[model samples]
Target: MYKLSPFTYTFAGRSKAKKIFLDSTLIFERNDTVAIIGPSGGGKSTFLKILKGIIPEYSSGKLEGEVLFNGHPLSGVYFQENLQKILYLFQNPFSQLIYPGTEEEFLFSMENFNFTREQMDREKEKFEKLFNLKNIWGKKTSELSNGECQKLVLASMLAIGPDVLLLDEPTAFLDPTARKEFYQYLDVIRKDRLLIIVDHHVDEIRPLINKVIFVDHDGHITPGFFTKNNFVVEDISLPKPKTAEEVNVTVSDLSFSYHKDRELLKEANATFKSGEVVAVRGRNGEGKSTFFKLLSGILKPKKGQILLEKNGKTYKNDKIFPHVGFVFQNPEAHFFFDTIEEELKQSFRFLSKEHTVLKDDLLSRFFHDIDLKKSPFLLSEGEKRRLSILMTVFLEKSLILYDEPTFGQDQKSIEEIIVLIRELKKLGLIQVFISHDDYLIEKIADRVLVLEAGRLYEVPRA
Candidate 1:
């Protein structure tokens, strides 16, 4: 059986990431379908990167200990060549996708793996139907949404026939039905490959995993906590606020025609309250993220405006960001920090606590826990996800908007997020969540707002 032993990794020294977060005492062996779960700053992703031999090799970092492949210590080995059998599927499928290449170019990656005209047609018919990807096969990869792109990536990975597949929050953006379908496919996927999934939707995933490795904010990996037969269901208390009757968000006669297409938001009008958490859901190309952008001032509304009501004052467009903090699904996309600590500092600026006044103990604990001194960009997908959330939460804005916070979390980490959200809501921070997690809605969202064909509608409580 394959194995990894006494593994340790740290990022390039940066004052920002002085933390020595991960100290994994346990070893990972074959036949162990380990699910690493933990808080946002926890070292879940870092652990996976080290195992994949990306750390200190493809990446520049300080690494200690050896990762044994069948009792043979192969630490800092030729990671890419050695681990060809292990595929590290990125969190965002689009990032891994070569944008400039055509679909045919992408499909036939290996020069030798060619398709005879007939075989190509047959393969197309099967995969297109299987993945619902018929329409965009000839189009550019940039044209696809997060969900559609993910299905394509999955199709490609399955084709490679890897021995182990490491996925990061693979279903964060998919609808509940699509999310279910993806996991069901993974559980029965033809390969005997040991599956290491770092996901956030635990309710849907709990049944499939073999064992769980629970990690804390301190980056401690404790394996074999929960297994298939040892599943324990816990009732989580989340901070779901009472819905207010007054209109908090008003979209008045919002109409937009993008690139000569029909109106995206055709005179869409709606109202939201401070305590309400609305989820925008629809098929890809339906303007989910677009609606968020309109509200956040990245894209000005073509016709109508998203009016935020704060202390009885109606603020429009750019005026609302200060009142409401938005946590993008890819927080790293906007982060220009040289180190994690700098990013933390920037986030802390929004806090009521003075910069010098912020607790050093908490900072110390955070750095030590998350290993923040390391190169933040070099972190694994899951680690990046957590760090982004931690930065947003630290901002302590009146309103917090999360595109998809739980996308790349394992079952345990998902639960921890639920707990944290509940606690934050108890503090009366306005939360606007755009997510597909039914479990998250049940726990944290007091009201659900669904977007259909770029139109926004609210699902009232029964």
Candidate 2:
């Protein structure tokens, strides 16, 4: 059992200024499966970090509360004695994964619990089958996709057999089928353990959650009820563009391989037109992200060419880097500046004179709640994602690629992103994104492409 009495936390901000992040009293008993829901940057993740004792230890913050574990105050010794029993899965898998290879990472936590060699092997096999991670067992951490990394981390935590598992946006990167499978495994283990989840996909896990806790923008908490009838999704519609036949980018005879024996893509060809939104969907390790990287010039193809056409001219993949804007799946990968405002300014420098007005408009729209002076790295996962997308827009590139643009986003934020994508299409800008959200694909995408057998195939619309 866990309990927090009149808890409150304040994060130290720039210039010695402090902002209250959380102020609420909560409790979790054994066999309690609770879901935390709120707007983006509403202290959902912060509250979880406080519960896991990560705020003061790993981050700079002030805490004023009494946290009890097993009916006693949580001290250094008390936390250590039950460290193995309490597991916290971070929002970003790269932050928690330490081992070089997937197999080693999966076994690292189990080995800490003194499991026998034979036991560890059996556990690894079980999790590999459950999460479909056997294919990536030998892959290095850096080589895995975002979805693959998420599955590996979840499999490793489940292998540890903890009594309390705190998962932050665990299914953010998983596809539809994989997300369902994840919940199936969680259902089995949650019967005898405490499962606390912070996710934006409330509808997917509605059947499994018994109670809901809503955190608001003002650091207030209130108990809420979950009802299927209350779910409402708005339909997104964009105005037609003046011209939609202009070819934006073309990939011809593209081939790429991470290893000599395994070919991820081979002779793949596709053409994207301006004023269109393309949604890339496929299973894990199917090279969706790889294709995006090739188009964005992050990775060069082993054989073949990528051409970007704009203003009656064709540019090679490498030469068109300035014309392409890519929002990585991990927002931190796209950040380089010390403060959020500086990141926006760097992108503004690349914008044309006609689009300079968008700088202030986007800043006030996307970052109204965020502090411009604060470090971009210190924001929450959802906040980081919003800032990253805004910066990419400021660049005013001809082609924009977003990888999992809706990951860790709440309902309102997701709607706002959809509106932005629609607006981009109306402006004759090419938008290609990789996402597992069916709603996003159905509402915004002009075409859906699935990667199969090292090639791209268009899915017939229903």
Candidate 3:
């Protein structure tokens, strides 16, 4: 059995260090299937770090607690020695990946543990079949989509056969079908191992979890059942599509590929009109994010043209960057400045004082509990995502591309994003986003574009 005695953790350095866990105690037994659920920025990820022996060791923090592994006190040395036994499935899959190729990542732990060739082969084959990773085999980790990356890392962890598995938002990037398959796979293999998952998609994972741990905003963690009233979500209206002929984006005969054998996009053509919110949908590794990057001028297409037109003037390639605002899927990669205040100042520099005040008010709504003086990197994933969105909106660009804008958001935060998108649409900006969230697509997208097998198809709706 693994147990965490009563403990408190305070983030270090700041004059007002934030307390993440206040005298929280939790226990886990073999084969215990537990789900950790809470609002955004409620210390779920932090708690997982503590369990993995990362807090106060790699990260500076004031921690007072006893974490035991099988009745023995867990120390850095002990944790290092037993790395294969206690595995952590990270929230950002890219953060944990070091190898260039997926196959190398799969064999890394096994090689370290000195597994026999036959044993490694057997375990790899089993996990590959379970994860449906044949298509992405031998591919570079950078080439895979976020969902594909998640699957690769997860399959690698399963190959190790850990006694305890810690997953943080394991399905945040996967499509509906892949998400179902992933949970089913977990349910099948969860007999002897202890599974602790931190996710916001409660309904989808409910059947797989026997116990639920709720972490509240007040730094309290306790056993609880799934409840909708845990968050106060405000009702928000969807964006109203507007008519604007002078502002539009057109992609003509576009073709892109990362490798000669693998064709990501081929002769894809589409148009997004001003004030229309478009959602890009596809299976994992289908290059939906690559399409967004092409449109945003972050990547050059191998063939064809992308034209962003506003007021009868056209911008192409690098020229489009000035008018395009992009919220990357990895929110941390989008941040450059140290403090949130410094980051926001970039957006504030161009706006009038009145507009700046309005933007400040919006930021306060989304980040009420945060201190602007703190680093944006210190914010939770959800908080970082929200900050990226607000900064993008403050830019007041002609076109915006959101790559999974609602990735780590909770119900309340998702509703708030809808409100913000609606406001942007009212300003007649052209918005294109890639998301696996059906509800967000249904609520916000004026048109849905499906990318599959290197072709783009438009779904006509009434």
Candidate 4:
């Protein structure tokens, strides 16, 4: 059981200090399964850090009051004394993967905790079976997809058999089928274990969680089964494309493989037209991200060419960069500037004077609630995702690729993205996004492409 009494936390920002949790008190009973829900930058992750004693310990922050585990103070000593009984899985799973190989990453924690080789082997075998990680056993963690990394980290944490497991957006990168399987497995394993999850997918975790905690953007924390429906996504009007030239992207006989033994994509072909939103779907580690990289010239194809045709001109390979906008799956890795305002300014150089007023309107609408002076690194995962999408779309490229655009988004933020995607489609941009969010694809996709068995095929929308 865990209890927090009159806790408050604040982070030092560039221009000002941002208060996250304010004089909040909460308690979780043993064998309780709880879900924490909130908007972007609303302090859900901050709460988890505080619970794990990462606040004012690993990271600098102003803290007040105390967090107790089983009536004892949950601080630095608790981590070492508890025998790895309390585990916190970060939102970005890649950050936790220290080892290069998947198997090594799995056993790192157990080794550190002084588990015997026999015991470590047993735990690894059990989790490998449960997570179906056998196929990726010998691969490097760097080669695995985000979803794979998430699975590996979760399995390793579970392998230690923690008494209290705090998962921050555990399924943010998982595909639909994988997510369902994970939750079903969690439902079976969560009994008698104190499980606390922070996720934006409220409906998926609804059946598994008995208690809900709502953290609002204004530093108010409420514990209960509360319904919040007041935030509505407002529509914004964007100008049409300056030129009427038709644009399309064609992938011809594309073949790519990271290793020689296995072929990830082979003879994959797809054509996306302007004024349309196309969604790519596939299982995790099925090369969806690899295909995007090939499209963006980040990686070269083994035996094919990607061509962008627009306005009686053709651009090939790296030459297509100017006409293409990409929102990477990991937003933090793509950010080069210190602050949100600096990031936006970098994107502004690509805009035309005619679109200056439009950009102002967008800035007012999208960032009015957020502090631009704050470092983008200081923002929550969801906030970083939103800012990345906005910055990429600012390019107004002929072709745009978004990888998991709705990864950690709340309902309102997802709706806003849907609206923005529709507006981009109206501007005659060829938008192809890879997402596990079926709702997003259903709402905006003009066509759907499924990557499987080393080929791309068009799937009819349901």
Which predicted model would earn the best TM-score? 4
Candidate 4 TM-score, C-alpha based: 0.96
Candidate 2 local distance difference test against the native = 0.82
Cα RMSD (Å) per model? 5.5, 2.8, 2.6, 1.6
Residue 359 error, candidate 2, Å: 3.0
**By TM-score, how accurate is candidate 3?**
0.94
Per residue, candidate 4 scores C-alpha lDDT tens digits across 1-462 of 888787777676436666766466788987789998877677888888877767766776778777788887766776567548789989989889899999999999999989999999899888888778987899999999999999999998898888888899999999888899999988988988989999877778889998888888776678858465546777877766567659988899999887899999999999988798999999888999999988988787899999999998999877888788899999997688878889989888888666767776666555436778778888888888888888898776888999999887777778888888888788888899999888888999999999998999999998
lDDT of 2 by residue, 184-230 (tens): 88888888899999987888788889878877766566676664333
In the range 1-462, model 3's lDDT, one tens digit per residue, is: 678888888887665667766465678988899998887888889888877777756777878878788876556677676688889987889989989988989889889888999998998888778777898888888888899999888888888788888899999999888899998888987899899999988888888888988888766778879886544555333233354335788899899999898878999999988789999999998999899889999899999889988888999966788888999989887788989989988977766444555775677668647788889988888899999988887787889999999987778788888877877787688989998898899888999999999889998642
lDDT against the true structure, each candidate: 0.63, 0.82, 0.84, 0.84
Which is better, 1 or 4, measured by lDDT? 4
| TM-score of every candidate | 0.75, 0.93, 0.94, 0.96
Between which residue pairs do clashes occur in model 3? none
Stretches > 4 Å off in candidate 3: 22-25, 229-246, 352-354, 460-462
lDDT of 2 at 222: 67
* Model 1 lDDT per residue over 329-378, tens place: 67577478877778777877776533235335334422335555556776
Count clashing pairs, candidate 1.
14
TM-score winner, 2 or 3: 3
